[model samples]
Target: MPAPQLVWFRNDLRVADHRALAAAAAAGPVHAVFLKAEAQWAAHGVGANRLAFLERNLRALAAALGVLGIPFTVLEAPRFRDAPGTLLPWAQAQGATALHFNDEYPLNERRRDDAVARAFAQAGVAVHRYTDSVIAAPGTLKTGQGGPYTVFTPFKRRWLATLDLSSAAPLAPPDPQGPVRPLGPALEEAMTLAGAAASAVPAKLWPGGEGEAHRRLTEFLAEAALRYDSQRDFPAVTGTSTLSPYLSLGVLSPRQVLSALLAAFPDALEGSGGPSIWLSELIWREFYRHVVAAFDHVSKGEAFRPAFADLPWRQDPEGLAAWKAGRTGLPLVDAGMRELAATGWMHNRVRMAVAMFLTKNLLIDWHLGEAHFMDQLVDGDFAANNGGWQWSAATGTDAAPYFRVFNPVTQSQRFDPEGHYLRRWVPELAGLDARSIHEPWRYAGGPKAYPKPLVDLKASRERAIAHFKAHAAG
Candidate 1:
């Protein structure tokens, strides 16, 4: 009899379109393992909300793995270095001849994976890695000059040209091994959260499992895809797919998402309407991941454009606290922040507004806002969060121009229109008319309980631009 194959779970929690799991099962009877690296998460500044979300998803994943005759094992390892010690001995005990896992691109994750590969190789066990998370692996696409493309347009052009639909289609779940025992409660117990983080899970807003992910994708394609481009910016309208949480957790793969998309609109890339715009968003996610890998400094919290490293960011704890608490006095920014706090999610357009308010208007360091988003967001992937903050702050490759600072009031007035979104999140200003809603500060005593503007918008905007100009000129 052949030795059993081991499939190690990380962010890719789903059983379908899972290259590692599929490959492992094809080789022989598959067993699965998940390491509860809560200590590692803490060290990485991962917030409690996301941790709770992960726990919920892991429970779902465990059930799915059990049905496939894979005995799921959970262990605790504080950090990446501890993984080999935990995994190697287990693989040997399980009589596993090979170890398999999907690739993760972060610096620490890469280091940990490289270490695991070496240790397994030393133990005379074959190790296999599959790129399941991204559609195209990083560094595969390059410019005519034979170098990585830093700008998004050329990268996207190459990406679309290089895309092979047949290869990117979702894979079928592997055939089950018969008469396997159901998973025990041990794995579930290992994943339970404790302390304040335990209460932060947005259980209703985000249900775990691949089933929920598919339901969301299906619903979006069926009902919302046509209007996605026009209504996505409006926070009140449910124009966007709520699949980011699933995508970020790898409950849904980009290929699975693209399959659904193409099914609805075959010519989505060339056609106008919702499909085209939404496809662009998916590519943006891919671009950021690629950028993180190609430009290693971003993972280290350094600005993509080194010149912005000397940016004179303000130091204000009170302002930071206000922004976090949704009391920033900019209606749209506050609303976005509050929505994130309540639901572990925020509308994409509002995300830009709040990010800009923090990094440009308040002149706070973009890293602070980036870290805060990662802590609070259920869909927080480091690459996306880091890319967005840096872009908003004009400190990243292919960033919004430094002079293009967002005017929060205009953004709210344009997107919210009648202030429906603001009313939903900022109930204190609910009584105010639409005219006063966007700029509540203009209202008498600012509509009762709302805080006054943290900084003069025009003055701060000018200050940010001047600072950037001075640095550039010098």
Candidate 2:
């Protein structure tokens, strides 16, 4: 029998510098397969919007694999209940000797990988797991005492100091055209949506596939990197690198993003401009991944810092509806929420603001808000969403202090000063001038149909502060 290697496709789906695929294809003939864990994705509340986008991305990947003369197979594995046992028999029939794949970090995924490793070992198959998720894997960075970092600032500082230019360099896209043995069945054009799929995606919402990802990287490098700092804060402006969706789906690797960023602005990585700040945000992603790895409890919904477990939170349903539907009555909050509802995405600056409104201003549970974000955000990742929500609520490690509540009105006047974003989502406010738009209630007429502020900002901030302070004192 010819030596065969099985490449299991996970989040790291692209071929650019894919260490696992490169290694496996080097050894012998390659068989690439993707496990469609429908039950697991559904159970985790993976919204139709995200699933639909995923399907489009997978189609693009399948096409790319075929051009390289590799057989691509997508097998249905509902949930991870019998993954290892189920997969082993299938692999055995194919007469595979070695299993090659990248690592997964989420709680359930980690468990699934462990079981698969054991099963493969029992079958006398070597399972080789490589790192393609982040720039540096978790536990690679640590304090002098060898303890996991509870603070982001110090961790980021050390991370910047340890940056290696070699790994951050650009990688060429995969060349699949090579002499190889026939492996598995080729893809069929008729293979389409799995189930009751949602309506077609908006033309301008986002572009899918590795090709688009590379195109976006080139365009952003040429245009947006220069003004990434001054313009990213404005929701109405197209200043930010809107690469989160591609990154979250693993259509594009962080390695590729960093390489492009560094090439565009070599000085910006260390300077005081947009590229530097943008790089900082990327570092934030790395920091949260490390936090999740170090504090396993975070994966299971326990506070990263346990003292925050008792933070008082109102799990109100009606309030949640208002928040999710963009009818929260605060223009900025409503605009941010509406953007999420209509497009399945939101601006980053507004993301933090709205998250704080729900967790701090409304005194609602952060997890509830986090869940809603996951349901809405096209780029949502469990670790990043949880880290952000818990941070906004002042419950996670190095969380935002309870005292620093963002004044909604002040935030609007500062960020969306012209009310352009507000006008786009909440069109009723479009007729109002910028001044009246941010605080509609301040006007005597106050746009005819829009609702007034649902909860008083000052009073809510006071209550949230008192609650956190009293809990701390007790």
Candidate 3:
């Protein structure tokens, strides 16, 4: 019998289109290991909702691996520092001669992988890493000056021009090694030790597994892709594909998504309508991931653009608390926060509104809002969350201009015109008419249960702009 090759599962958990898993299976008999570094994740502000989602996906990965005759083990590392010590002995015990894994680009994860590589080298075990998480890996796209592209538009142009279809095509799942294997007890024990619990998000809201991910993708492409540009901003309508959780956790691959999209709409890349816009959104995801890899400061919680770093963010704890509790009294912002609290997800349009409300309107620090989202969001990916909050705060690459503040009332009137989205989340204002629901403060005999607007929107916007201007001048 040939020596086994151990496949280390990280963010990329699915069986199909998994380069590391395919490589491992081809090398020899494959075994899989997932290091449960829950403590490290918790320290990084990862909340119960995301951890629960991860646990569910881990279980799904184990089941899928079992069908391919690969034994899956869950090891309780608790921290990245413990990973090498925990995994080395397991590999030696299983007589595994090589280890395979897809690369994770965040600073801490990169350091951890490097340490594991060094340890494996000393132990005479080969370590093979593959890029499975992104369509274009970081450092692959560069400017004419031979540096990483900071701006998005030029980077996107290069990405589209330089994309090699042959290499970007998704890999098929590896052939089964032998008969199916029964899952061992380590997985359950590791889950318990890692403190996996019931998620705040409902299971029906986000079903685990690759099959569920693909089903959603197919349905979204078939039904909504064409109208995505038209309906995506409306919170009440299911215009956007609710596949972020799957994409964040790697339950589905970008290649699979792209292939499916092209199969449905051949001119997806070139068209001026919905398909192209949706593709731009996907490119935005890649751009953030690349940003994380290229710029170390963003991953370290520093602003991408240094000019706005010292914009004198306020320390309004009361305002921050209200924002978190979804009682900021601004209907749209409050609704968005409430939606996040209830489902561990919020509409992208509302995410911007709430973030801008916190940072610009209330004068609270963007860091507070960023941490709050990381602690509440089920689809909380560090790169995306960090990139988004910074963008709203006008402190990131291709950020909203400092003078630009999203008027929550105007936004509510435009997007949730009939108040369907507002009423669904903020039931206290349900009886108010569409016009009044947006700005109940202006109407007489408004709901007494709903609080007044937290701040004068116009005054706050002017204040934020003045502050940024003064800071820039100084």
- Model 3 residue 464 CA deviation (Å) reads 0.8
- How well does each candidate superpose onto the true structure, as a TM-score? 0.98, 0.95, 0.98
Off by over 4 Å in 1: 195-197
lDDT of 3 by residue, 1-474 (tens): 888999999889899999999888888888888888978998899887888788788888888988988888888888999989998889999888999999988899998999999998899999999988999999999999999887889988998898777787888888888898777776655655344464567867777899999999999998999999999999999999999999999999988888888888889877878888898888899999999999998888888888877778888888899999989889999999999989999999999999999989988889999999988887899989998998999989889988899999999999999999999999999999888999988998468998888899999999999988888778
- Which wins on TM-score, candidate 1 or candidate 2? 1
> Candidate 2 lDDT (Cα, whole model)?
0.81
Weakest ten-residue segment in model 2 by summed lDDT: 182-191
Q: Which ten residues in a row have the lowest lDDT in candidate 1?
A: 193-202
Q: For each candidate, how many residue pairs have backbone atoms clashing (under 3 Å)?
A: 0, 2, 0
Q: Per-residue CA lDDT of candidate 2, range 373-438, in tens? A: 877677878778888888888888788887888887889899988999899999989899989998
Q: How well does candidate 3 match the true structure in TM-score terms?
A: 0.98
Residue-level lDDT of model 1, residues 115-144, one tens digit each, is: 999999999999999988899899899999
lDDT of model 3 at position 240: 98
Alpha-carbon local distance difference test for all models: 0.89, 0.81, 0.89
lDDT of candidate model 1 versus the reference? 0.89
